[model samples]
Target: MNKVKILNLEIDNLSKVEFLDTLQSGVVFTPNVDHLMKLQKDPEFVQAYSVSNYKVCDSQILLLAARLLGTPIREKISGSDLLPAFYTHHQQNESIKIFLLGAREGVAAQAQQNINLKIGRNIVVGSYSPSFGFENNDLECQQIVEIINNSGATVLVIGVGAPKQEKWICKYKEQLQNIKIFMALGATIDFEAGNMKRAPKWISQIGFEWLFRLLCEPKRLWKRYLIEDIPFLLLILKQKLNLYLTKDYLKKNSKDKRHSWHTAGKY
Candidate 1:
């Protein structure tokens, strides 16, 4: 497996370029600290990630934590970067049809338009914004699934944010027969459409993109970053310590085996 388990979640250790180039048609899960934390308690989220064929690192903070834990990921292949790059390069390939799902009412449509404009091709075939808690309503979920199936889209970019987007994929991706790839893109669609801005490159590189976002949307994000996500460091440390102990155990066992072999040879 080209993966490492940190805090009991499997992370693919592939670079951004490699991940994009080889990205197959399946659930594409991008988990940051917030998501990994949620996985501890949310069986649906665990099911979502467990079934993902592509599990790329979505957070620079997560990258840093991995490096410190002795399981360095190759790179961040976040949805924010993946969505635009995928369209920019693959839009010319007519076989790859796309659908934008789960932004605000008109935002997914706006993103579809912007992407088509930027790519100079109409790769996006459909756009839909499911209402809040629409997944809770079985009829609504089936309708959304049917709309996607009828659109003839090969890819579906979902921007409903964390657990909801992931849960939607877990429950409905297999039924979306037309969709080859399902991306839980969070706010990336809004960022792509100019409805919101992503963090600056330097800020993102330094692993403070969370802070930048928190500052930008303080009311909605402050508690997430400060309270919920801060405790994630403790989780990281615990994993690191566990990894260290395991390595030490392996080394000690190997050494003991070698000594026993030498003593047997002398006898």
Candidate 2:
């Protein structure tokens, strides 16, 4: 299981099907360009990703960048897509209990209801929507831990948002019980609950999912999509150029050495 080291993160080079087959029972981070950009400037964020058991490329932008950098990833496994696929795959596996955590209060509850109706009712055992900045409040965080633990769920889908979800899992993993899998699934819950409409498959495939999201919620997402993520493309281009130069230099060096060796032999 090799990882494609991109920027400050090492994303697992795995396709959806391959990754699903070998899902680890630990903290998982599905990082996109914005998350990766944060990893550059934020130390606590770095610490969170550092402790993550699995880092999957959840952005087509990253997937395309990896390919351009000559370290192509297997596939893009966005959280929004993974939730439904995971539920569908494990539909009959009643033993695989799930707990949904995060979102605006009652959003997770709605997600649970939607999932039960659409995906499978039996798979979701528990769900909770934590208050904003709950991670900073030890008592509130502890309560969440206890609720998820007592629910006897095997997987915990955390959507409190990045860095926070990662930091929470990284910091309080020891307190959690029964929950075997922890996934930082961003807004997958909202999408699942029918509160948000996901981009069309064609849009996602063509790498305009971000644009679709921007159009959907420009007020919340404009800064992130425009200001924050613009540099990622430049970074990717820099890596691609550096890679190209390094390979060209190596090839030239090999050719020069071969020519020198031939002249010496003739002498």
Over the full model, what C-alpha lDDT does candidate 1 score relative to the true structure? 0.78
**Least accurate 10 contiguous residues by lDDT in model 2:** 258-267
lDDT tens readout by residue for model 1, 55-77:
88899988898889787888888
Lowest-scoring 10 consecutive residues by lDDT in candidate 1? Answer: 258-267
Give the per-residue lDDT of model 2 (tens digit) for 9-53: 789998889878788577788989988776655655676787778
Candidate No. with top TM-score: 1
- Local distance difference test values of all predictions, in order: 0.78, 0.79
Q: Using alpha carbons, what is the TM-score of model 2?
A: 0.87
Residue clash pairs of candidate 1: none
lDDT of 1 at 131: 78
Instruction: Tell me each candidate's TM-score.
Output: 0.88, 0.87
lDDT of 1 at 39: 62
| Candidate 1: regions farther than 4 A off | 243-267
